[model samples]
Target: MTEQYLGLPIGPADTAFGLMAEYDADQHLNKVSLIAGAYRDENGQPWVLPSVKEAKARLAQDQNHEYLGIAGSPALINVAQSLTFGSNMTKNLDKSIASIQTVSGTGANHMAAHFLARHLRPKRVYIPSPTWINHQTIWAGVGIHIEEYPYYSAETRGVDLEGMLSVFETTAEERDVVVLQACAHNPTGVDLTHEQWARVAEVMKRKKLYVLFDSAYQGFATGDVNGDAWSIRYFVEQLIFNGEPDHPGLCVAQSFSKNFGLYGERVGVLHLVVPRHLAAQGARSELLGLARAEYSNPPRYGASIVETVLGNEELKGQWLRDLDTMSSRIKSMRRELRRRLESKETPGDWSVLESQIGMFSYTALSQKQVTRLREEFHIYLLPSGRVSICGLNEKNVEYVASAFREVIGFNSN
Candidate 1:
């Protein structure tokens, strides 16, 4: 008898990172990359928030390479809790919430999936159809049944509220998990309006669904951290605060990568909030156990940097301004792209460019059009038509617009 040890099928390269590799290998002089979700400045360079720079300067004198606890930095968790749920809510949620630091939003999501798969054992997990590619990958690891509910309406370039709610009402059973992007949904950039949020909350409350709110773009969405958090807060209020006792509470997977410009640092927090009458101490212990087995300890340097900026009033203010700077630039580029396309009489509705918020947009370009832009124009974007608005800048935006016009079969006179 023979035993086979190490034979495995090769897997395809990650679409985004694979394209990133191609973009990097490219030596084209006028090449433009609308690929990664990281923010880029007007000059199309990676930008570090001024607050983060200052925080690093301060930490450089006193920072150590010591390992954080398995659950990560408590100080960072404290500030992150306050950031996501606001200070008052953080205080009020004392007995009801279990929070731990994670590798990043990805780790938080992974932890939630693993924890729920073991503990809550939901029958299925529902995610937006065109969500961040990683969402599906993360859930699949936990061996849960994953389904995609309709999300963005291509016809209207908006949230498919009716379609989403119909699935929730008809198909979703109690304790089933639903992954909701807290703000500025990835790929599509479309968010539920406040009224729409309330409707979903009512259904979730009624259906007794467990929610995993992915809070990746809090301040980065519109530069107003509080405003971006409205959905999470509202859901907490509706589903947890005012709902029935049997309702399995919601959790938020918060990330510091985008808002703090600490992408490479891999800092994030996972908050599991239970009902008011229940204590989250047991769940907290389980999360800590999972964290201990997975990574041992979260990174210390990034947590210090985050805590430093968020803990101090002056640095936090500067961070807010930095958010404004990044968000405003993204908005302006959206306008510029739309203007250029419209002025050139490009095909289809370009107004979605301006209406969509945050770093990426569901561009609606077909795979063929996307390929043509890459081959002919040296422009790189996801084949699914998701483009990182951050990649557009003053120098390359017009070129990108023209590439779109050409690839979409529009040739202006």
Candidate 2:
């Protein structure tokens, strides 16, 4: 056997496993856990939305074991369409939109990237500089070149909007694909204001660029579905109102993990808004073909639960209420963390934490400080100092704030 086959190379997982084993054996391991993803309840436990439980109950009584089509559950797909594009989206129901269920957000991204690589043939896909770590890996895995656009500015702890627009304006026409976070941006929790989104849409339209929206936290972001969907809805509206029937724009990847509290279930949708000129049946057939080769069909359990909740008025209302509860808790945690940090008179402006929305806060700590936070303080977070705000509660917010202050405070001296 060749050397490559004889000895497989170590990957990130091996490195992570080794590092975690050492930490597991160390004393004082309970200080903090450094997981960057995954939503936790106030008690630092995995959460299952109450609406999901009720939906599961309804599905269990007369559930069919029959295999879903390669494109996944039709009812689930319909519900997904309605949830993202709105119930009254004329273009959506008119067959101008093509949607397929996928394993989850990551899967949806992969599917879209593959399609773009094969069909769109853009020079490269431009992703945010500090986007979800998996984004680069996913695009590159499909043999597509990946480039970075300015996103988070560490100094200001906010978006580098001007820098971002500059890159987009100079991008060669029809040669770039820009991936946008549809709602709450991950890792930083910072989001674009309505005005900023409008500006971005206008620039992209003028440049004739393609857009791929990753909406991982739609309802979870603000507990208001329409509020979270404002950017995407505006994009679609722009295309329709402009009467550009053949506009070469608009694709969306939506995840049910965060909002539905269905993390491990791997449920998501990949949709494309095709030109009105294309035969509706033809567009749907093409999208389904893509799904046929990728995963054959998405799992039914999660999709069934989603459809059950969303298709029923009472269950949908219940789901919204549950989402509000989750959003409220995270909002309270942000305020409390800000209050605690301010009380300590932390050197830098910690006000950004309060201004930023969503489940995380980019704490702006250097990699060295982040290391100390983990090694000495047992406070777990990404090396970039992004903390899952959902992990904080009445019990741990003060402790986390104090640890943060101590690290930064000592560093300043």
Candidate 3:
């Protein structure tokens, strides 16, 4: 095709999405797809949570097809904020939080980059080396000088807490932004313990570096909302509330796509929080302006469903159970895979599979091993060897383990 635009270079297809397409085209009957981050049922199908189904049914009565204001639904913002910070802190931190409903987690992250790159004007923004694939692309689009700090150590198969703190202590400057995954870290499911978080918080407070918390999996991580949010809340108490006067404050980009199982609905919120001495009204207005320029308002239906589920007591109970159901199944898959791999004496330490939390597991499988899994066994996962634990179920866990045994070779660990 002739160039439709003057100076546009051909871009490669998105890695994850392109691979998903390849998985879709494969005709193998026993094909297992551990590619997507989405949740699947025991039957290996997309699940609509019972709570969400009920919420949709309730929405069947009162529905409106109107354009939400530039800032989107006010109700969603309130519930989202409450869910993020919990009710007490939401009230305690009264005038210090600037929150706006967003297109989704991606939209919230994008808006944050847009606002911060222009206003805070940090010399460098640091991200984890093996974070969500979109983190790099999203920040890059906003034209920020991006730096990657060490996060996961492949040799240890754990958090590189010291390395992470060293970067913040030495290289990071005041007002420099640090992106932190609140819990259930993507690709590599390793999350820092409370002590580890506290150590990092000490460095961040001393350095006066700004924080941007990306909370994509709340209750979805461990079936406990508060447990998953412990890191963020700890940072809130340590950095903003009790830190030095020069503390730059922090923001949270909360996503409802996973926890609420409303992925396509695209419901999320960005919360910009300042110290009690600072006011957030001006920041809220600025966020409104950014929202106005890009995608004006967030989707209403998803927000409404989430709001309904969270607002009603019985539905909220159902939602909690749903969270447990999803998380429990992912955990089970992890155990089953580990049990099978170890029972067969697969090479290396298979214990990491059970130890890593949430949807993904960094199997540390080599690129060549991953390729062989796809080509020979019709199994699909990221080239980085990140496997979606949700993809395995009673039906395919043994198959996946056997495939791993073949690629990795058999050895006692």
* lDDT of candidates 1 onward, in order: 0.93, 0.81, 0.91
Model 3 spans with C-alpha error above 4 angstroms? 1-4, 410-413
Candidate 1, residue 180: how far the Cα is off, in Å:
0.2
lDDT against true structure, model 2: 0.81
Report the C-alpha lDDT of model 3 over 1-413, residue by residue, as the tens digit.
Answer: 68758778889999889999999999999999999989999999999999999999999987598988888888888888888888898898889898999988999999898899988889999999889988899889888889999999988999999889888888999899999999999979999999999999988898888999999999999999989999998899998789777788899999999998899999999999987788989888999999988787778999999999999999999999999999999998999999999999887898998899999999988888899999999999999999999889999999999999988883222
On residues 12-49, what C-alpha lDDT tens digit does candidate 2 reach at each position?
66333454465566678355554535567878778889
Q: Stretches of candidate 1 above 4 Å error?
A: 1-5, 410-413
Model 3 pairs whose backbones collide: none
TM-score of each: 0.97, 0.93, 0.98
Task: Quote model 2's TM-score.
Answer: 0.93
